[model samples]
Target: MTKSLQKSQSSPSLHPTRRFYWDTESLGVVGLFTALSKVVSLMVALLGGGMNPFTLFLKNGIATALLVVLVARVRKFGTLALYVLVGQIVSFLIAGGGMSMLLPSFLVAALASDALIAACGGYRRIGAVLAGVALYDLLGRAISLGYSFLHARENMAMVMVAGVFIVLGYLGCLVIGLPCGAKFVKELRHAGIIREV
Candidate 1:
């Protein structure tokens, strides 16, 4: 092959490092955020006194904000997948409930979110990042609601009530979470903790 052709083939622009691999930095970021998310969730659950509308909004909003920072810091395709996997594992280990029931929904949400972000121009674009995160939250909640409905088929009213609460939490994610996360990302960028990707 010609030298120019070979060089083009191996160009940094075409490299897969950012998209495919999980380096030390990537793993570290994911671990930090996952831990942070778990702590925040537990705190919210305890302090806010469980899944009331206010607590639902607060928990989901904070988690979504954290997720935005995670995606921004990682700037990779499978970052969400790794985040979800670790989160589920940790929750199951610590809380010991419904891991099997929820894992599939979370995994599907993360994968679909990653794919959507990639299709929309990867994590580099703020819009894509927000959209991906939004989709992840919405999809996960919807799937979980469906799962709950399946198990509680006799209590359609209860399921509907739960769905309303989920919707409230999702609205929080979109309205409160996304903006807080974007602001945090900007601050982190200015502080040089998160370089432009």
Candidate 2:
């Protein structure tokens, strides 16, 4: 009886008509995280200024950490892809045409990362969720570097410099973001905000 009670407590409220669909609760969670991610990104850029070492590390670290938490909280397929799409759309509206240039790379990375997570055992497994976030960061940066090279063909040296910063940003994600996100998840679980499975 206790086991059945626990199951009912943890299972999400599903859509009445669909076996696999994001219900209202899940969509609300995604929307909240998406807004938080963009607000954090914008604030970091304004406060840190440009792509210097401090800005690169701080921005990537916080953004990646937020993404990790978002995935854990949502625990569903396409979470990363939806997050990227919504975030980028907001960026395009606020930052203008310049933001659109990077959309392809971001979208592809999100899709691939989401697929890997789903294949590995879906979001219920913490390992898969972490791996997905890491892959999203790495692939997004790599693809953006390739795009940079193509557009700035005359300034190959600058592209290399950008590549160096990308590496640093990823290191920030690995060293700071991942751990911080995990800790935050633990805290959230403790606080009853993230129900355990």
Q: What is residue 62's positional error in candidate 1, in angstroms?
A: 0.6
TM-scores for all predictions: 0.84, 0.82
Best by lDDT: 1
Ten contiguous residues with the weakest lDDT in model 2: 11-20
What is the Cα-based TM-score of model 2?
0.82
lDDT tens digits, residue span 1-197, model 2: 99988787666773344454777787888888888878887798888887878877888889888888889988878888888888788878987877678887798899999999998898877788889999999998887778778877898899898889889989989988888888888888889888876
Clashing residue pairs in all predictions, respectively, total 0, 0
Residue ranges of candidate 1 with Cα displaced over 4 Å: 1-20
Q: Model 1, residue 111: displacement in angstroms?
A: 1.4
